[model samples]
Target: MTLPAPLTGVVPPVCTPLTPEGEVDVPSLLGLVDHLVTGGVDALFVLGSSSEAAHLTDSQRRLVVRTVVAHVAGRLPVLAGAIDMTTPRVLDHVAYVVEAGADAVVVTAPFYTRTHPAEIARHYRLVAGRSPVPVIAYDIPVSVHTKLSAELVLELAADGTLAGLKDSSGDLAGFRAVVTGARARAGITGFSALTGSELVVDSALALGADGAVPGLANVDPEGYVRLDRLCRAGDWDAARAEQERLCALYGMTGVGDRARMGASSSGLGAFKAALYLRGVIACPATAQPQVPLSEGEVERVGKHLAAAGLL
Candidate 1:
C-alpha cells in the first residue's frame, strides 16, 4: 500500500520481544502493540533505536515489520526504522518494509562515516527516489555520530520525494532549522518534525514541530497521551509539565549508559531491563545483544519507577 500522510503525534518506538531461547517472541510483541495502541498512541515506529534494530538479524527485522503491520491492521500508520550504515542496504530494507505493508520508512543518513551535507542530501534523495513508500529522515546525532543537516534536508525537500523528518538530535537549533525549511514548502504537507527528546516535546510543539516519537512513551504511555492531548488543545504550560515528568521517567532507564556498550550485546540488555522495571514487557528478550542488567541496576530501576509514581 502507498504510505499515509506524513505522520504526527506520538509514535512509540516498540521493543522487540524475544523468548528465553532468544527467538522473536511474536506473542509478546503483538501484546505490546495492542497495549500501545489502546494506550492512545497515534502511530507505531518499529525496528527503531529503542527496538534494538542493530541486534536483530535481517530475517528478524523483516518479521518485526510484518508482525507490527499485522498487529496494527491499518488502525494507524506504521513507520519501520531502516537501520543500516550503507545506502544499498537501507534501500533494500526500505523495499522490505514497503512490501510488508508499512506506511513509511525512517532512515538516518549513513553512519560511521563523516558524511558531508551534499552526501546527506544524496543519501536521502536516493532512498526516497527508489523506495515504493514515503521516507522519514531520522537524524539521531548520538547514535549515528552523523547529522542530517536542515540545509541538506531542504535540498531534498525540493524533490517532493522526501516524506518528512524525525529529528532525534535533540538540539533546538537543528529542530528550528528543519521546521523553518519545511514551513517554506507550500505543496508539502508540513514536513513532519518529530522530537525524540522528551524534555523538549512541548517546546518543539510550540516551535512548530508536528509531534514527537519519544522513547519515554514506552514506559509512560498514559502520561504521553495526556501530553499529546494537552498540546493539541494548545495548553503549552500543562504539556510542558507533563513533558518534564516524562523526562524524569526516562531518566530511570540509564540513557547515557547504553552508549558505553559500543555495539556489544550489553546495550540491548539494559533496554530490556528498563521495560521490565516499568512493567511494559518481561525480561530476557535477547541475551546476545548485551548481558543482563545487574541486580543493583534492576533495583535502581524499580526505585526510579516508584519515585516517579510509575509503579
Candidate 2:
C-alpha cells in the first residue's frame, strides 16, 4: 500500500505516564497527550525510546497504544514504535498495532543478536510485507549497536516496502548517503528521513529530511516548532540557537545515562517529574523501579527550566 505524504512537522517520542504505585498512569498519559497537543507538535509517537517501550510488557504496550490512539481522537497521526530485535515478534506486534489503528510503525534493525546486512534487509522486507500499514525504518545504533546500512535502506526504498526511515545514528555521512540515494531512486516518493537527535534538526532538514522525532520535544515541543520554522524559513543561525537551547534541557536530564535512570528507562520519569513540578502533568509518579529524581536533581532541573524560560 502507498504511504501517506512524507510526514512533515515535529513528532515527539512521547513518554509513558505511570501511577505513584508504578501502574500505567492512564489519566496522566491522557494529560500528557493534551499537553503535547497544546504544545503544537504535529504528531505523537507512543512506545518509542523516549516512551520506554523496552521496559513495558506486551499488554502495557498495547494499552498505551490503544489509549493514545483513542485520546488523540484523530487530531494527529499516532505512530507506534514496534522496536523488537526479532522479526516474528516484531511482525506480530506490528499486526496488533495496525489492528489497533496506528497510523504507522517504526521498526528498528534487529539488535539483541548480531545479524548480517543481507539478513537485516530481509528482516525489514518481511516486516513491511506483513505490516498492514506503512513501515518506518528506525536506525538508532547507539541503543541497539546495530547499523542498518544506507545501501540496504536504499534497496527497501526502491521496493516500496519501507515507507520512511529515522536516522538516530548521528552519522552525517550515512544520513547524506541515504538521502541522496533515495532521492535518486524510483518508487521512493513516500520515503522520508527524520533525525532522532534534536541537535541535528536543522542540519537534517538541510539534507532534505522530513522532520525530527526528538526526545527533547517531550519538554520543549514549542522549541522544536520554532527550530523547524527557523530552518524552513532559511534562518540557520536562529535554528542552531534553538537547537542548542533544547540540548540544554537535555543536559539537565543527564545526557545518555540520565535518560536510562532507575526503572524509568528513558528519562520519562524525570521528564514527567519536571512537568509535574511545572504543573504541566498532574501526576509526577513513574512506573515501579523508576526512581524519581533526588531533591537536588529536581532543584537543579527547576533552575535550568527557569533559566530557559520553560518554567
User: Which candidate leads in lDDT?
Assistant: 2
Compared with the true structure, what per-residue lDDT tens digits does model 2 show for residues 1-311?
22356888799999887766656888878888988899898888898888878878899999999999998878899899888979999988998888888999999888888888888888988998888788898998888888888888888888887888888898978988888888887767867787787777888898888889988788888889889888899999888888888877776666214543743333565577677777766676656556567667677767778877988
Candidate 2 clash pair list? 263-289, 263-290
lDDT for each residue of candidate 1 in 212-281, tens digit (9 for 90 to 100): 8877677666778789889989988888888777777666556325544443334345446666765556
Per-candidate total of colliding backbone pairs: 3, 2
State the C-alpha lDDT per candidate.
0.77, 0.81
The superposed Cα distance between candidate 2 and the true structure at residue 286, in angstroms, equals 4.2
TM-score, predicted candidate 1 vs. hidden true structure: 0.90
